[model samples]
Target: MSGPSLYNHFRTKDEILEAVADSVSALVDLSMFEDARDWRTALHEWAVSYRAALRDHPNIVPVLARGPGRRPAALRLADAVYGAMVEAGWPPAQATSVGALMRYFIMGSALGSFAGGFVDDASAYDPADYPHLGQAHLLAEQQEKIDERAFEAGLTALLDGLALQYEQARATT
Candidate 1:
């Protein structure tokens, strides 16, 4: 599938990139947004699903990182998140922020992650030089768990903050 054969399906780089983004976006579990009772729960589920999908197709993460553009699947994802948030009582602006914020978290995770950035050398972190990073050398070996935990922590913090903001807005309204 090299050269002309591949080019037959995608004549231009933009077309190829758009196709990749669409295909990857289709893997995400947008259905999570449909039946959940709370926006927080729905967004949490969707984010987890989105991250899982991205993990499997990490090479496409950069393409997905670009805003929805004109891709149908990508736009649907954007619409679903923003719509779900607004329907759940988020202000329009806040809903947009939720979409952007979630994208950054999920796509950033799919892109080369902090935990995975460490070299897997036991002596990389010298005791005297990196007193605080005694266990840092193990990070590469534990990249999966570390990345998952980091995602969970980030998602939790984001949702908690949004929940508080939503509550305050509701109280005032």
Candidate 2:
């Protein structure tokens, strides 16, 4: 659509961005949480689904990170995720923060190319100057595996921390 045509439907560029963000959120399968046994399970499933959606539309990751601006789909997705966290025994404030944290993680993962941007040539990392980067040359050959493992590790760490919080919250109450 032309700029003028888009403007007719969206009052400003921010509005268009909000629409795009909503569209991207729509791609996520929130229903995956419908039968979740616990909040952690529900959130893990949701996060995976969300990450997949963002991966499919890496271009919208920045826009999504900006926050949902009066967009129904985005709002609904956020609400569902937060609700699941609360239901799973998290305090409201903690749940909200966890939701934000997960969003930031997913956005960062989508926006950055962990492996693709690496300089894989062995000569790029001289042993004397960059002894720690000895594995740099292997990055290009193992980019996909590296990226996937990094994402999984980060996700697991985040969830594990959140689980601890949940347990602590339960103990306090």
Candidate 3:
């Protein structure tokens, strides 16, 4: 179905997006992030789930890339991330940074993958002329593996940074 037809079926973009987001979010293991009493465990699991969900649904790329407010799914995910950070004992300031990092990591990686929307068909570059592009394409071919590492590295760094911030907050209080 076309965009217009889809939109007509739904009252507004927000409603459609919310339904889409709700469907996707339901598939995720939210308990992994919420149930973990330890902050590290929750953060790590949340990161892993976010990246995995993004990777699995390449079609949601346009929704996510459009902007947080434009897509209910993105907004829902953002809220969850921020909520998780708060539950982990992060300060309000740190919540924004931490959620932003997770969003950036997942969406940026999704965009990097050729699987996502908006293919650059106009830009043609020879692998011989641009080795980096060529190598990137090869890596994109193995997106699942790359996604795992990206999630792990990004999650570890985010958690470590948040941990430091929490310590600072503790020190002051």
Tens-place lDDT per residue, model 3, 58-166, is: 6665666555664544566667777877777777787888777766766776655433222333244466776566434345456566556665776688779868878
Tell me how far the alpha carbon of residue 52 in candidate 1 is from the true structure, in angstroms, after superposition. Answer: 1.0
Better of 2 and 3 by lDDT: 2
Per residue, candidate 2 scores C-alpha lDDT tens digits across 1-173 of 77899988988998788888898899888885577567777777887888888988888888888887788999998888888778777889988998899989888888877778867688888999998988877787787677778888889998899888888999999
TM-scores, in order shown? 0.93, 0.88, 0.65
Q: Give one digit per residue, the lDDT tens place, for model 1 in 1-173.
A: 77667788888988988898898888888886787568989999999999998999888888888788899998999999999999988889988988998899888888877887888786988989988988877788888998899989999998999889999978887
Instruction: Please report the TM-score between candidate 3 and the true structure.
Output: 0.65
Sort by lDDT, top down from the best: 1, 2, 3
* Candidate 1 runs further than 4 Å off: none
Candidate 2 Cα deviation (angstroms), residue 84: 1.1
lDDT of 3: 0.65
Give the lowest summed-lDDT range of ten residues in model 1: 1-10
Residue 87 of model 3, lDDT score = 75
Which parts of model 3 are misplaced by more than 4 Å? 1-8, 12-18, 65-79, 114-141
Q: Which regions in candidate 2 have their CA more than 4 angstroms from the true location?
A: 1-5
